[model samples]
Target: MNKLTLLLFWLMPICLYCQEDYDFDALLDSTSVLSEQGAYEQCFQILGDLRQYLRENPDKEKLFFLNIHEAYDYTRFGYYSKAECLFKESIQLAKELGDKWNEAYAWYGLGYVTQDKVLSNSSLPPSEEGKRAFFEAIELLKAEGDSAFLVDAYDAQGYAFFLEGKFSEAIEYGEMALELCLKLNDCESEPNILSNLSEYYLAIDDFSTGKKHLQASLKWIKEHPGEIADEIAYNVYRNQADILIHEGKIAEGEQLAMKVLEYAMEHKDPYLLRETNKMLIDYAAARGDYEKAFQLQQTFMSQLDSLHEMQLVLSHDRNQTLLNIGLRDKEYQLLGAKLYSQRVITWSAVGLIVLLLGLLSTVFILNRQSKQFNAKLKKEVERQTKELRISNEALERFAYVASHDLRTPLRNVISFIGLIQRRLKNHNDADLNSFIQYAKDYANHMNRLLNDILDYSKMGERRLVATPTGIDLNQIMEKVFPMVKDDFREKQGILEVGLLPTVYGDETSLIRLFQNLLENAITYNDKETPLVAVQLHSVANGHAVFCVSDNGIGIDHAYHEKVFEMFTRLHNMEQYPGTGLGLAICKRIVNDMGGEIWMDSSEGAGTSVFFTLPLIEVEHEQQSQENGAKAAMAVA
Candidate 1:
């Protein structure tokens, strides 16, 4: 089966509920079509509505099935982690209901969804977790004697084996699945399995058997046209033509190949067209048409070269969608909270009015107490107003800087794209390639800038809720080293660690802080022997001070404060490469943790980055103080 057909099959929702009762068949069909057409937002909106409806109605079975579909949708579109979580939920739901059938399907979903590697040796599973899930699924389905999903499970295993290069195992599994499909009268899967088997046979050099399977698949397609997927039918034709060409049936093979090529061109399927061109090249070579072969090979290479550009665009779109989805989730949560808060405030105002009416007579008698109450209320309101203003101003400033920085890279990309287009028209391959590479670089830079902006915006949102468990600096360095090990090796840099202390902070944030500081230390250095030293200072006043000293070209005192500002860069891109928000993020993280971060250095001298983290003992002391105050209040 072709990739599109396989994706459609894999994403097909396994409905355990009655479509007539739900009256959602039309909706499901529409969403499925939209998903297939790559209109993910439309699909998501429809699915989201269905999800909300299910939440209100509380149908566990329908919801579970819907979750599988949604998970598969995400999986098909490269959202692996999100898909894995949803598949896990589906498994749990099926287990809770003791529904082995659904559980089996859920496990099957997880097997494919969570498998990271495209292929692995039979000696080692593509993904051990995925392999285990597949086995568990097969066992459960086999126990229940359920052949409907079992056929699919077997087919999946066959594909898995094929990808692993275990051809014998793949054939075994494929035959098993085909047998089950025939027994169940499942025409839909039978043809696909036959086509798959034909490929396997061809790979093993059993042309006779391969031809038989291909012929069988074609016969099925001709007989059951409505049941066969378009891509599957196309594959059957393509493979048959390939076999014919290899068997010296040039005229017949060329006709079939041309038909397939026409279809691919009409559908604008560059990949399939490229494949057809390759097969034609082989046919031309067989016929001793060397000139035609060379021309076809050049066309194939051009198409193959364009695939990277296609992939780059696809990657950008997927990333943008993921980012938009994340931001939307945050916005939704904030909107919900704001709505709740507004409702509370509205009710509170009504209550306050009623209280004022009831206490109108007693107000004059309690004037002094009322005055104190008014004073406190006014002070609280003023404090909140000031905080709101500061937040607004900060948000506005961030937006401006983010837009400007983001637009600069985008402009570079657009300008280079135009250059490449013009060069393409002129047929200047060298200029076109140069401009294409530049555009790609600018796109990458833009992506990085956007990520940095996102980080800066999110820093305040996560207001460092100090965890009770302290973070060990040594462990953090160990964790962070791998991320920059290549850079360190490339620069021949050395790092020295000293005795470190446990500090109260968020581990993830601290890791980012240390990583940025260390990276900058290595990146900015012009020393003959670059060295970065991390050490702990004596604890004082409930804080643990630390220093990351580096033998690098030091920053001047004039630009020290500017370094902690968003998008602030003291050096040009040629001299240093970064989004310039790393130190800003580090500063925000430190301040959120109730600590300070600063640099102590001057130009031409080595730099030392000093930061302080709250001592774990200080957190304990604060907790004790809070407990004592609560006890005193209770006694009073």
Candidate 2:
């Protein structure tokens, strides 16, 4: 009887553990199915239960699974911070357990959450950490020979690059994912990869390639009906519509676009609806249906505002959810502590007192730390606010200066018009004609000033908001040279361009930058045979300095610094006609591109305008190697 009681006592825990393990496995299977079916609430419930079980059983493998699933559940609800914390925990647990597969998944989850966080906050730049995480996950999955998950990782990385405006890189990764998906006969990701490829190609202005990929995506969807989601199908259709419109197949494109609009409306997806309406607006404008375009524009604006409000609400809800989760965790901890204290007190009152004192100490330390953190945060906020105020004051000063400058042209126009009106009664045709021309010139000057001001303001905003890409200076010069070739021809001047390097910048801005400099070089010359030369001045420290030199009526030393100021001219309008905004615009563009521009000249000496641009190192090196090889071949 004694042996039987001892055996049962020992066997009881083993039996319970086995039963618990079985239940855990079943629950995990259920969670997987529920997750696949998009029943995230049920998945979360199971995950919570598993979390509680793990607290008691302490199974590393089961804990990793619980963290991963719960992290994904939180992620789907936009609780990114929670998801990130859970993913990090899973990563650590997976590493401890030497589970490469789950470790790869945990890294992938972390990267995906990071990507989501960046996407949610437009102010944030593309995440390098996210990219590194994805790379780690991909390498591990490759080592594990897990091609299925590898496809997802590749697709995700491609999408991340796409969001960052790295279209070429995006295309490269998308192609890899597509090839793998095709080889594995994985129809699930094929359409998505193809659709994404189309967008990437289109972004780089490879319309034919983009159209081909769009068609392939559509065909894939047609062949694999129900495999693709409704959202994906509509997105593919929208791409097709955009391509067709670009191809001038207006009727067909509009038809497809209308279909997408219907789908968006039916689904009540504000983003899709606004996008479709914008496309329709463009279509209407193209067809010269201004009324329809206006109506669509109104609708698009309304949808945009609604979408912004929805985003705000979603953000608030996510923050609230995080707060509630924290509160619940604290409540659980307090409940557990209370129960522990009760059990300890049952054993010994003295031990209970010690436990209570320890709890109080922890709480006091945490409260003090929280207070310090709050104080630091408050100081940081105040510092930022002061900086913002200074920036705003500077902007106000700029506005005041701009308005003051603008009034000069207006006054000239008014004065000239009054003179013309008074002289009309005197029948003075020559004076009247001269006054009219003067008025026209001032009005034209005002127009030019307004356009330049707009460009300056827009460029500043664009520099802050737009994603820059690799721009070949050679290509930019090709576009810019043609624009100023007429000026060169008229002056009968020689315009020489040296070999240019590729740089990281906005294409349009770069083109404008060169155009302004080249035109300035040609326009400012006083010599009979003006010589304008564009040459690579120097290259060092990942920057290329280019010099645009001109045998012009050079700027005086006294006026060199002032020349870049807005509407500051060295010469009169009659001698050298301009808004004087050229150098100002050039300076703004150079500064915005993280470079400097300055002129080296005396009054009679030829001016050399030197500017720096960030060099695309790989491209510059390749070019140099090619040049070296050519030189060797020439010697041979």
> In candidate 1, where is summed lDDT lowest over 10 consecutive residues?
116-125
Clashing pairs in 2: none
Q: Each candidate: RMSD to true structure?
A: 19.4, 23.7
lDDT (C-alpha) at residue 498 in model 2: 63
lDDT of 2 at 373: 51
**Pairs that collide, model 1:** none
Tell how far residue 89 is off in model 1, in angstroms. 3.9
Question: What ranges in model 1 sit over 4 Å off?
Answer: 1-33, 45-63, 112-126, 131-133, 258-293, 340-636
lDDT of each: 0.71, 0.73
